[model samples]
Target: MCGITAIYCENEELTPSLLYYSLFSLQHRGQESAGISVFKNGTIKTKKGLGLVSEVIKNSDLKNFESKCGIGHIRYSTSGSSSLENAQPFVVKSKVGTVAVAHNGNLVNHLRLRKALEAEGSIFVADSDSEIIAHIFSKSLSRKDVIGSLEVLTNLLIGSYSLVILVNDTVVAYRDPLGFRPLCLGEIENGYVVASESCAIDALEGKFLCDVKPGEAVVIKNGEMEKFKVAESKEEASCVFEYIYFARPDSIIDGISVYDARKNMGEELARESPVEADVVSAIPDSGVTAAIGFSMASKLPYTECLIKNRYVGRTFIMPKQELREVSVRLKVNPIHKNIEGKRIVLVDDSIVRGTTSKKIVDMIKKAGAKEVHMRIASPPIISPCYFGIDMKSREELIAANHSVSEIAKILGVDSLSYLSLDGLLKALKRCGRNKSYCLGCLTAKYPLSWSEDEK
Candidate 1:
């Protein structure tokens, strides 16, 4: 999914540098492109491109952007191509005023919505779900109040989205009824900040505020915040993947500790799928927590076997497949000392194509591990993600085509075990379940129907 952040302040300096720093805190969300829309004098000014946050914003560039209300985004390509127009926060010049929206997660009904708007003479710039939303709000200009029109707009749109909207004097954040993506709120000295994770807020030294609840909208204006629930409907199937994989380890989502969730996932994995091994290690980064859990549950010593390169850019589009391979190679190098002559149990989050996981298994063996057993924190991903995740087709998914044993053999792991669906549900409930969550991709269910064209 993509990451989005915005702030509204009356006393703090409205420098673009502030947006740059905040967006940099969220670079993990999107690697394809980045942009920010600044609202000043009833207009939304925007700067965007295909690059990192540091690459997109410059010293002179930030100086040109000055506004009390602003919205920023880093896009990971989902619905659109990797192009400039697809970058967000997309700004539109409407008759009522200038409106801009940056979004995370995917809209299932995007194709239908875009066609309807186009038939009604709406000129489009980018092939993106965010643009459909902006045009819908643009059509409701007669309603005047930004949030009210947006409320109406939300009802017509279907699927998962965590939206941050910017207009003159107002910065608002809205989560879809199912909350398929994570968004949080924070408070700075003189402003209110909304971001994809608490990490972004903490980066700016903002105090932790609660997550934007599913089916709710939070509006930050003139240093004040207001909340509104989605119109009377309460059924929300939030995305379950946030716990097992996605989010930053340090961030808390929906009041549940993400690290705890992962650790619990590992514990459950050990229960559902146990294997014999000498040492338990994790694929560098996200997989480490679950590995710890597995190690604790299985009573195996946990060791740091994979060391990651801190300088690697986001891993979504690596410029080329060759580049992606090199990047992964450069990012993680196995520790021969930890793995040598040992039967290693390697824990990882999820396996999409099985390419990376397979390579990792081979790397450990090459580093001197006697045996490599692969353990996945989540169940086999049989279907592609229609959400903001970059996985595109089932054809590319190894599990979708091959059975578990087949996949294990392909990866050259001694044995493989994935967390069961029951385990995932159990892991989340461990943190206390106050809200409904979406297990669409895992369960082959969705908040909205998937069109054949989308496939």
Candidate 2:
């Protein structure tokens, strides 16, 4: 997906730095590009480019800007090619005023909608699905009814979207009816903030208020807040993968603590597949919490067998397969003392293409592990995610084509086990999430449908 942040502050000078740090907290959500759009002196000024938040926006740049309302975005393309043209916080002129939009989640109907908009002579600058929302919302603003425009905007599209739109100085935060992505509102000094996750709000030292409800829009203006039901709520399908992989452990999403959910997943996995091992180790960062829970439940000694390099970005999101392969080696290293002569139980979030998993297993074995029994916290990802996740093709997914035993052999592991779908739901239930979360990647059953043209 992507990271989006919006701030409406009485202290205009604080907006830039607040947005900058908020985006930095969410840098894991996206790494391709970073951007910000600020409303100042009756106009919107946008600065965006291809890079990390720190690489694109500097302290000097933040100090030079001043605004009462602003929005920022960090992006990694699931729908469009990675380039400056596809970067977000996309600004456009609307009938209401100057509008800037930042979106997280994919629109399954984007291609068809784009073709229709083109037939009616709407020009397009980028292939990003997010740009589609900008065009539709800009046209709907002609109705002069903000809520009514949001109603119209929601009805015409399908799939997931968590949006932060800046119409002049007003910031509107909207979550799609299915709630396939995460968005939350927080209270900052003399103003309010909306972001992709609560961690961003925490980074700004803001008090988190609540999640932006499914099918609801929260509008902030002049330091006050207003709420509206722009669309009818459907069966909630909040992305389950967020807890398993994407979100920071400290963040709470939809009342469920991400760390607790992952730990519970590890516990469930331990019950489902108890393994004989000398020590338990994690893939690092994302997998650490689960590995801890696995250790607790299985009564295995927890050890740091693999050490991650902080400098390397996530290998799964690397732009090319070749780059991903090379980065897997640079991303983590085996601690020979811990791994040598040990029967290692390796825990990780999920295996997408199986390349990185295979590489890691090989490295652990080469470091003298007697056996590497791989355990995945989530169920095998046998289907593609249409909402916002990067895995778009079933062909690219290893579990889609191979059985568990085959995959274990391919990865050079002694054995392999994935958390069952039932086990996943049960773990989430313990986190107060119930059964409403989306399991499309694991079950091949999606909340929405897509056309062949869009696919």
Candidate 3:
């Protein structure tokens, strides 16, 4: 997945630095690339590179862009190769004017749409699905205005997307009909803001307004905001993984607190699979909230038994499996004093390939833990995710090929238990998020129809 942010300020000049800091808050969403595009003096200026937000957008670069409105993006490539050209807020010159686009989520019909555009003699610059949006917007401008163009584009698209488009001074944001990704609106001092999460809005000291409804398009211009219905879906399939793993714990997505949902997941896990242990310890960051709940429910003391290396990025998101395997130790280390001689209940979000989980359990054992009981807050991920996440093949998923008992033996844990699908739903309901969710990875049942070749 990716993080996207847009801002429209009426009373003061837009600070690119503020956009930079906002992207910093969303750094967890993506680390491969960072970019920002500003509408200044009737032209859209953009700067982007393949690196972390701070590495790509320096303090000196911020001074180069000045405007009353702009959009920013942090990308983790799921649709395209990791290259500078694929980095977003992709800016292009259109017949209407200069239009820059930033997008989160994937399009299942990207190849089909791209082929159709190419047959019409459209030359593509970037390989990303995001560029398809810019091309569609540019082509639609020949017949319709910005809003109407978005409507036509949204209708033709078949997949998950939360998009922010900048046309001159107007900023348009829209979520796909399925609402597979989160995008919300916020009220800034003299204008408005739209971002993939409310945390980005809070980073800019903006007041969160509400989530942009599924199939809804919002336009912010000249300090005024307007909302439009672009398309409709019979049922919304918001990604549950956002709360389980992706989003920042501090962020509230689609009216649910991410931190609370995670905690509830841990509590439900304890209720469903109670474990006897001296201490409940998280696998760090993602698992911390759940571990707290697990500790409270099981009446086990919670401790920071695993110390994470602040310098390490997420090992699972690393591009190569070998790199992921080698980097596990660099990412976390067991606190010998806390974990030694203790029967540890190791709570983690989910195990994808089992490589990292195996290494972590081994590390804790070597640290003198009597026995390691692995507890996953979510159900086993047995299928690939095509919407936006990087899990693209079932062969790469350990759960798809192995049983729970086999997995536990493989990891060398005393026992392993994953939260049941029903348990996960109960936790989400506890957080008042009873809406339909995309559990395709857990059940191999997708919300949208797709060709066998796509999988």
Cα-based lDDT for every prediction: 0.82, 0.91, 0.90
lDDT of 1 by residue, 317-389 (tens): 4434676777777788887899889998899988877777878888888999998888999989887778767
- Give one digit per residue, the lDDT tens place, for model 2 in 77-193: 889899999998999898778999999999999888999999988888998999989988988899757777788878898889999999998999999998999999999999999
| True lDDT of residue 319, candidate 3 | 69
Collision count for each candidate, in order = 3, 0, 0
Per-candidate TM-score against the hidden true structure: 0.95, 0.99, 0.98
10 residues in a row with least lDDT, candidate 2: 144-153
- List, residue by residue over 143-179, the lDDT tens digit for candidate 3: 8998789888877787889999899878899999889
**What are the RMSD figures for all models against the true structure?**
1.8, 0.9, 1.1
The segments of candidate 3 whose C-alpha lies over 4 angstroms from its true place after superposition are: none
Error of 2 at 444 (Å): 0.6
Q: Which is the winner by TM-score between candidate 2 and candidate 3?
A: 2
Native-referenced Cα lDDT, model 3: 0.90
Q: Which wins on lDDT, candidate 1 or candidate 2?
A: 2
Our model 2 lands, by Cα RMSD against the true structure, at: 0.9
